[model samples]
Target: MSSKQRFIKSVVATAKADAPAMPWARGARRAAFIAKRSGVEMDKKAA
Candidate 1:
């Protein structure tokens, strides 16, 4: 179980690391993705 969990985590981490984030965007898409994964509610009013 531990090894499987480690492998999954590593895969996700690697995918994140390989993704492109432009200099102007500063990884905003990645931040939203991580927030969504953690069940954070997006505030449409602010957006």
Candidate 2:
């Protein structure tokens, strides 16, 4: 897969891995993943 695709997959995997332990972190990770995929930078403070 291409680098971009690989990044997306990795982000998803990471979010999944973190979900069970920390719900907030998982949500942040998911938001960040979506932002990254959309070529935007998420506001960390907001998250």
The top-ranked prediction according to lDDT is: 2
Error of 1 at 8 (Å): 0.1
Report how far residue 1 has shifted in candidate 1, in Å: 6.5
lDDT of 2 by residue, 1-47 (tens): 99999999999999888745565466676878778899997787855
For candidate 2, give the lDDT of residue 29: 69
Model 2 clash count equals 0
The TM-score between candidate 1 and the true structure equals 0.37
lDDT of each: 0.74, 0.79
Give TM-scores for every candidate, taking all chains together and pairing residue i with residue i: 0.37, 0.40
